[model samples]
Target: MKLAIVAVGHRQPDWISAGCSEYLKRLPPEMAARMIEIKPEPRGSKSREQLLAAERSRIDAALPASVRLIVLDEKGDDLTTLKLAGRLEQWQADGRDAALLIGGADGLDPALKARAAEKIRLSSLTLPHGLARLLLCEQLYRAVSVLKNHPYHREG
Candidate 1:
């Protein structure tokens, strides 16, 4: 199974890159994952809606073909690590590639959110794009570890 993390942001702090890289490097080869960063729309002279729409268009264009769309949004469903593992198992079993969409600061477009095959939130609280990217990478690695029964994952 392949996973694509398509996030709308560039120029994240060095710590975020290091953290994300660490988790990405830990992922096993079978569960291939790649990150695609989309340039964020400049907020200058643009309405909130316009920014969202611009980002939405770029995200739509960046999406890898034939992958399930899993978008990140504040109001989306909450998922536990185990639940995510179950989803990972299902995706792997079905040989499906999933595109995880992380929107810009203004959040996702309403229509784009509606189109997501799965809408999930990393946290109830707001997070910066860099931290979100790092956290998602770590969680995905944790889910893979659970699937493999690797000692890296410890259940509470």
Candidate 2:
């Protein structure tokens, strides 16, 4: 199944891009894991409401119509690494393309959260949005590894 990571914000630090690319390259070509970064709203002197609206608009426009949406939220379910691996397996078994949404620093808009098919949280503590993206990508790679019976993931 195709896996897409649809996230807000662009022009991340070099390290962030390097880290994400490293894991993404390790995945098999058939899995088709891709990172689609929706350009962040220009942050000049815009009001809070205007900024949020712009962010939402960009996110909405970047989302592909066919993929199932899953948002990463602190308020969402926190699953173990093994459970996440299982979840990915189930999605593939069910023949669904998964799109994971990572919102901006202010967090996801209420409408986006409501529209998600599933909501998952990495941890209770807040993490930098860029770091979160890197973490998500790594976890997805690990999940794929586990699903394929690769030696990358070892059960403890």
Candidate 3:
């Protein structure tokens, strides 16, 4: 199963790219994970709705057909690491590609969130876009590790 992280914004800092890359490399050969960076709409003088509308279009354009969509939002369900690992395993078992959507600075539009198959929150606190990407990559790696019984993740 292919895992795609389709997020708004590009040219992330070198550290962010490197951090995410490290985890991406650790994913199992069968579960190929890739990051698809979409250019965020310029905020400029545009209203929040306008900005989100433009971003929504870009996100929709990047989405792969037949892929299950999971939107990351602050108001979404908060999941434990083990639960996340279970979900990842289920997706792989079902042979479905999963695309995780990360919105830009202004956050995701309500309509877009409504369209996702599932909505999950990484944390209650608002995270910077770059940091959020890094965190997601790390958690994905951790989930893989847990599923494989790798020493990288251990329950206390």
In TM-score terms, which candidate is top? Answer: 3
lDDT for every model? 0.88, 0.84, 0.90
Off by over 4 Å in 3: none
TM-score of each: 0.93, 0.90, 0.94
lDDT of 3 by residue, 98-125 (tens): 9999988888877788888899999998
lDDT of 2: 0.84
- Tens digits of lDDT, candidate 2, 1-156: 888888887678999999998988888866778889987777899876677678888887877777788899988889888889888877777677888988876677788788888999988888887899899989988988887889988888
In terms of lDDT, model 3 sits at 0.90
Q: State in Å the error of residue 92, model 3.
A: 1.7
Clash list (residue pairs), candidate 1: none
lDDT of 1: 0.88
Can you list the residue pairs that collide in candidate 2? none
lDDT of 1 at 55: 90
